[model samples]
Target: MQDTRATTTVAQSGHATEVHGWLKWLEVVLVTGLFLAAGFWLRPDDPLHVGNTFAWPVLAPLLIGLRYGFFPALMSSLLVLLVAGWHYDKAAATAYPWGWAAGMLACGLLAGEFRDYWERQLRRANAVNEYSLQRLEEFTRNFYLMKVSHDRLEQQLAGSSGSLREALRRLYGELSQTRSEGLNEESAALMLRVLARYGQLQTAAILAVEGNRNIQPKALATVGDYEAVSESDPLIRYAMQERTLVSVQTEFRKHLKKLDTDLLVVIPLISSTDDLVALCVVESIPFFSFQNRTLRLMAILAGHMADMLCQRDQTMAGSHEWQSLCSQARRAARDAEAFGLPSVLLKLQVNEQDLATLADRMTGLLRGLDVIAVNRANESPSVVLLMPLTDELGLAGYLHRLELDIRENAGRSLWDFASQQSLVVKTEAQVAEWLAREGGAID
Candidate 1:
């Protein structure tokens, strides 16, 4: 196909060149004929007539020079000289006849040189334009490749929620293994491993609450040769009493005597039944701020650990929650198909910074029946919306409206990061197929 196109282009260029050659010859012939015709009709009877058609010959060479170029113009000038000599007597022609020919030749040469200069300029401009066009095409190709890579990255990050869910499942699996091995020794080791992996902690201890409201601090795990502090430590006491997290600082140095650590964090593990099950004492570098998401994650892990310690069955609630949401969407899709109603599922990629605001706005904007799920993974947070009665066109309109609202209220930065992908799934089978194709599974 490329060869055919190249051949066709070459053929067209050759044809154009031939046409230009014909036009150049025709221009020369027409100017020469006009000169001859005018000279013959206006020839003076007096041999030495000052007003004889000498001027007509000048035009032929000048026109040829301007049109055909230097060599052709010079030849035309010689031809004019011959014709003028033939028409006039030798004596009359000899009188300043060479001067006239010289003038015509010089004029033609200058005009032809000017024409050549202009043609060279035009060719250079065309070359520049061609080079620019080639660069533009290359840039477009590179931009497309970059876009594809970016899309793949986004897709990978989009699966982060699933990845987190998988990690949680593995944690549960570890808990199951511990249970099978008789929970006393194995459970503490597994819990320490889980904590070290997720909470980024090194030196830590776990304290269990006894039935008599007394808490016993146990050195469950230690990463280094470190002394463990007692439950009576102020940090631990405060964390347990407040049922919240506490970090050791300069202000608590007096209270944390003998616990000479650069950093310390105490997290309370509260059970599902509102009972304080245990407290996690972590001594490490001061890494996390109070409001950091890592702290929140640590708290969540502590809760799960508390549940595990309380002998509660690990239900994989996070995974189950997502599964339930997908099931609801699937049911909604099936019902929509049965009732011949419209339904659209929209997947939105949002900037992590704008996620909270966007979620709040979405909740307010969407219909009551619309299901919105925000995957709160830090890598690439996203929101999924299942619009039960919205068709493709309706979805488009909704998107447009949302975009306008974002631009007006949220500004351009928010709008820039908010991108949506939509699918019209009318049946449960279609939804399942889409989920499978996209590597999405609730379980």
Candidate 2:
């Protein structure tokens, strides 16, 4: 569906050629007939004489040049030279035709130059937009890929953690650690030994996204004295207020929790949506904006951790949310392709607010595409954008943006929340071919 702006351009070009198609033949006939008529009135040996006002006959080339293309411009030039022979003397009429053809050539060259410049600018802008979109999509896809793998990796590691617990407990009993006080002392001592043995950090803390009290310092890595902060501790509160790590005094054990977190990297956990999920309190210095690439890397890792945790929780807790979303997508993808007119179904998960705006933007984005229908009810909440075209890859590249804009501030994760798919296809080209293939053409 082209906008009125584009349609108007086509209409103008088409109308010009159509009008000229009629006018060109008429001009030939009228010029010839008018010359014959002139001979009857003037009645000279050369009634269509060289001195006649119409004798130059050179204006025809310019008239055709303005209305048509180079071929017509050249033909009109020759026609003028031929007609002039009846009116002009030998040397002059012959010379006039060559000069007239030269003028037509100049006009043709100018029109070609205008077309070249116009097309180059249009292609350049489109290329820039295409590169920008590809970068953004690649970043988004890698981020999600990291997340999905994280959840799967955590599940693989869970069983090994149980052996660590059992071995440590047996060591405790063998060392006369029966008293509660003795056990506490041994537990603290054992923590340091394990950190040393594994060559891990002096302090670290696990921060869960969905809850407050689930933080635990395993001291995976820390440079100096280790101490963790309680959820409501002043350091944590300050960082939360700032949305950045404040890196308060190094002697935080006196002012915070007993668990080690002194060499602290108070990393803010962020989801794919850019929302802070929970803080990954580690024993390293804080750095960079939440939007920076380094921060993105850390966030990617943390998101993967969250995904692993969520997968475990879902498996253990018997959740069906993610599975349901997947099912919806598979169904939508199969239905979206070849739907209605030859078109492309763009399955996207849009926030309720963007859904309407997308429909409007799509009209412009898909102007060159043969899009005939958009279906929202087909399992995927995002419309199945239909485009009728010869090349699906080119059309997909042309409009891949529908997904990019939604990513920057995607209201919700379509994959996480909705199962959906999109398709792009050809229109009359497809339908007519299909009908012919299935029926009369075969016979």
Candidate 3:
């Protein structure tokens, strides 16, 4: 009883909602004290003893309420009442104990219910927080992808707009002069100077290969500064033999180590007869290397220049020029571009056989782009030029221009309607394959 009384008193003193070990012991001690006090104070001979008879037991419920809470109150009340009833033999004493126990039991049930309710509420709040955080992370990821896609689209549109304006300017100029030289050497030189002035580190040179004594006329040959690289230079030899252009760092390791070495580009050209190879070299130095698109542009410009030289020679030589000029021009106008830009894979095609002659012509004609290689298709005799801005309208405009150019220059059409359809189908297939390889967007 003393232990129970001690436990109850300790429980009564603690924070109401928490059950503590010390309180339980204290209540035990407290209960024992009450029982002992009542037993000692009672007088069996007195009538007042009957009323005081159930006092200890009745007090037990109240004590339990104030200390051990509802459940404990109920148990203690029942115990006390039973002791009182047995001692006094009064029905009223026994009834009061049961009533006290019942009241204490109800209190305990209410307290436990409230505690459970609070626990459930806490769990719900935690779950909601976790779900919200996950959603926020997903939203952020999607937002970045959308932002990047939007920016890329915008850049492409701007570039397209600029190209259109430039083309329009050329059309207007052509209506007036009607002569043939769209951009002369002077103009081309000015473009390079401007690019250089704008911090782009512009470089220009030319190469012509007619039977292979590579010749550079303006910049490559006479910048007044010459590197005595003969046909024997390993980089040059490797480039010619492999018939593929290699990066300067990968090709000319010794030059790459030189602090003064600027960026260098090598472009190759093959003639119509598949007999000549021409190489063009460009040298520049800047904080950043040239972008892949720029490198490709260099290769393209070289190819165009080669075709022009071939045209000039044939035209100057007159009518029976083996129909040579027209053949070269036909091949030149058909090629287009479709490679990924800003990295690598820039290309050009040439159709010539006389190395020295081809090299000399390529050197004079190529201005900015390099000549990477000159090779024949092992499987097909055709040249492929990936069309830029190539939706239906773009294709229509390109076809119209190409047909006119080839017929007027060479008296022959590159491809008729059916042929062009086949070419487009092939190009589309190639584009699909390339997209898959690059992990880029599909058309």
Q: What is the lDDT of residue 207 in candidate 3?
A: 43
Candidate 2, poorest ten consecutive residues by summed lDDT: 1-10
1-443: candidate 3 lDDT, tens digit per residue:
12233322222233334546676646745774565455547655422233443433345455554444455555555555455555456534434445544544455445434444554565587689889989999999999999999999898655432332243233223332424443344433432332232223435343445465554443422122334334444555555665545446655554544333343655554433233335645555343535554454444444443443344333322233223323322333333322322111212223333323333433443322222222232222122233322344645564566556556655665443113221232233454443233222222
TM-score of each prediction: 0.41, 0.23, 0.41
Question: Candidate 1: where is the Cα deviation over 4 Å?
Answer: 1-163, 180-183, 211-213, 248-262, 285-291, 311-443
Q: By the lDDT metric, which is better: model 1 or model 3?
A: 1
Indicate the TM-score of model 3. Answer: 0.41
Residue 372 of model 2 has an lDDT of 30
Ranking by TM-score: 3, 1, 2
Residue 89 in model 1: lDDT: 56
Candidate 1: Cα lDDT at 432: 70
What are the RMSDs of all candidates, in order? Answer: 18.4, 26.4, 15.1
Which residue pairs overlap in candidate 1's backbone?
Answer: none
List model 1 lDDT by residue over 1-443, tens digit each. 01111111112332423335556556677787677776566654533233655555677778777655676677677776666677665446456556666776788778767766665676687799999999999999999999999999898556332233344455666776663432244676677676666665657666556652567755545554457676577666667666766676522644644554333777776653345756667766335333345565566556555655653333323344344346545645644653455778887787778888887777778764566777653357777777765789989887887777777777764447877777887767778776543335522
List the candidate 3 regions with Cα displacement exceeding 4 Å.
Answer: 1-100, 134-184, 187-204, 207-214, 217-232, 237-244, 248-264, 269-279, 283-297, 308-422, 425-443
Model 2, residue 366: distance off in Å is: 24
